[model samples]
Target: MKKKTLLEELRSGTAPPFIRELAGEENMDPADLVDAMLRGEVVVPYNLCRKISRPCAIGAGTRVKVNANIGTSSDYTGIEEELAKLRAAVEAGADTVMDLSTGGPLDRVREAIVAKSPLPVGSVPIYQAAVRAQEEKGSIVDMTAEDMFRAIEDHCASGVDFITVHCGVTTRVLEALKNNPRVADIVSRGGAFLAGWIIHNGEENPLYENFDRLLEIARRYEVTLSLGDGLRPGCIEDASDAAQVAELVELGRLVKRCREAGVQCMVEGPGHVPLHEVEANVR
Candidate 1:
């Protein structure tokens, strides 16, 4: 039989020690934390494979988390510099760290960061997939769905506690962007990769179309899914537009599915809104 996910354990009254510890950190009762987890209001991102030295709980009734992104770019690629950034983030009291390295032996960089990070390590698996496609097939659009899923599995197996997946970048959302253009359209790297793949292939976003497969792999590692807003505005001018909201609407739908699967999930969106629009947007 397969092992139970943190969600299942919470339901069974057998949540892990780290999860219980998270409640104490939040100044919440263990039962209360369990209740929040059941209600999908709280998420403790703890992967079974990698024991997090500094575990964290994100969501309602908890402190706002700071997830610092540390990684190498195509121009600047090295493990030591990235590791120094990791140390800096931890020292600065970051709640989590995401390895967004798009350069220098992606696998090695990710694995090294995971081994060294005390905070829960997160990553954008699509980066490696897109990079691999560009190197091997000469274009990001050449990356197969199998290659994409494989990268996700590899990251989870490497003990990444969470991942940012741009599942909300759908063909419809892309269409919305076409109808309603932005001054700085699709600034997110992962988001742009998926968008390009969808338009070039004339197919649906694989992440959205094959979310179940992604969920299964996530369940196996018990990694939290950060459902990213692919069409999130890049500037104040593009803020809160129809294209952005359309992606959020799709993400809201996916959030329900994530909960139903007993997989911990977070919705990352609606950023870059105007100061005045923030109030209404949050409302």
Candidate 2:
């Protein structure tokens, strides 16, 4: 029999040990924490693959959390440098750390991060997928759907506690972008790869098309799904545009699917906006 996911167990009225500990850390009643989780107002991003010593909670009734990103880019792929940043994140009281390495020694870098990070770890696995496609297949647009899913699963098995997925960049959303152009069309790297792939292949986003497969992989590790809004505003002029709202609609649908699949998920949002639009964007 398959193991019950954290969400499924929560649905069965069980508060897992980690949740209890996190509640105490937040000085919140465990029952209240569990209640908030059930209400889809809180998340504890922990992967079963690794036991985190510095796990923390996010969302309603908990202190605001910050995640530090450390990784090696193609131009500067230094493992030691990344480790230094990891140390800094730990010392500076980061709630979590994400390894966004997009260079060689990818395996080693991620392994080192998971090995050393006491806090929960996250990643944007598609960066590796896009990198692999660019290196091996000659173009990021040439990467197969299988390649993306494989990257996601590899990261999950490697102990990534959570991951950002750009599944909301759909064909319809692309069309919306064409209809209403922006100063910055797509500023997110993962989003750009996916948008390019969709245009080149004339197909739907593989991530959105095969979300169930992604969910199964996430369920195995109990990885939290950070549903990324790929078409979020990249400038003040693009704020609340049709493309942005269209992508949000797609993401909202996926959140329901994640709930049905018993996967813990969070929604990412607005990128850049005018000062007066900040509250509106958040709302």
Candidate whose lDDT is highest: 2
Off by over 4 Å in 2: 275-283
**After superposing candidate 1, which stretches have Cα over 4 Å from the reference?**
279-283
The residue-by-residue lDDT of candidate 2 on 107-152, one tens digit each, is 7899899989999899999999999998998999999999999999
Alpha-carbon deviation at 252 in model 2, angstroms = 0.4
How far off is model 2, as Cα RMSD?
Answer: 1.2
Which residue pairs show backbone clashes in model 1? Answer: none
The TM-score between candidate 2 and the true structure equals: 0.97
Tell me the TM-score of each prediction against the true structure.
0.96, 0.97
In model 2, where is the ten-residue run with the lowest total lDDT?
274-283
